[model samples]
Target: MEWLARVMGARRAIEVGTFTGYSALCLARGLGPQGRLLCLDINEDWTHVARTYWRKAGVADRIALRLGPAATTLATLPQEPGFDLGFIDADKENGRLYYEEVLARLRPGGVLILDNVLWGGKVVERRQHPGDTSLQAICELNDFAAADERVQPAFLPLGDGLLLLRKR
Candidate 1:
């Protein structure tokens, strides 16, 4: 992610599922000086831990965290001079919605990475069942992204899976 940011020369970014902020730190550090990152996550406890590390890493001021539903928080962000990248790894059910919102706000040629897309390989299981909600959600989101015309999409065989989309 840091490499991607550097390659794109990205100065503004947002992360939908901050978790422990490891990804955020990587993104923030890559932004370097005169850049800003917004982190959206619902868990206060985990974010607290992230804040501590961000301070130690000296990137705390570069990142602003919001604690709430990612969609709700993303709506609060402005559209102009939009984000260069978006990393999604939050609630599986709302992954598609988050992708749509982020895509709309991302600048041209920007990227959006949806993580855990393979769902431990359940996405391609022979007897895939609807009972596996996360798997179903990932399948649906993957289909939507592939079929969408606004962005060029590619799937990477990484940990679980990664769906990379670059907005046209």
Candidate 2:
């Protein structure tokens, strides 16, 4: 993630699910000295630990933490394409919605990455477990993104799965 940000010369980025702020740290370090990262998460406990680590890493000044529902927070931002990079690792049920919101805000030629896309390989299972909303959402997103013309999609099997979309 850090390499991607730096290679793309990202100055403004946003992360939708900042669990412990590790990803945020990587992004903050990748960004230029004057760059900024917006972190949105609903859990204060996790974010507190993230904050401590960010401070320790000396990147706290470059990141802004917003505590609330990620979707709601995203909706409040202006409709312009303001982000050079985006990472989404939040609630599974709202995965597609988050993707849409983030992709809409991604600048031309920007990158948007969605984590846990394979959902432990359940996305391609022959028979899915009943009520497995996460699996369903991931499969739907994979198909939607691949068919969408606004971005070029690449699925990497790193970790569970990393879906990368470069906006056209």
CA lDDT of 137 in candidate 2?
77
| Model 2 weakest 10-residue run by lDDT | 126-135
- Cα lDDT for residue 50, candidate 1: 96
Off by over 4 Å in 1: none
TM-score of each: 0.95, 0.97
lDDT of 1 at 133: 75
Taking the tens digit of each residue's C-alpha lDDT, what string does model 1 give over 18-56?
Answer: 889999999998888778998999999999999999999
Shift in Å, residue 97, candidate 2: 1.1
- Candidate 2 regions exceeding 4 Å error are none
Model 1, clash count?
A: 0
Top lDDT: which candidate number? Answer: 2
**Candidate 2 global lDDT:** 0.92
User: Could you report the Cα RMSD, in angstroms, for every candidate shown?
Assistant: 1.3, 1.0
lDDT of 2 by residue, 93-113 (tens): 898889989999999999999
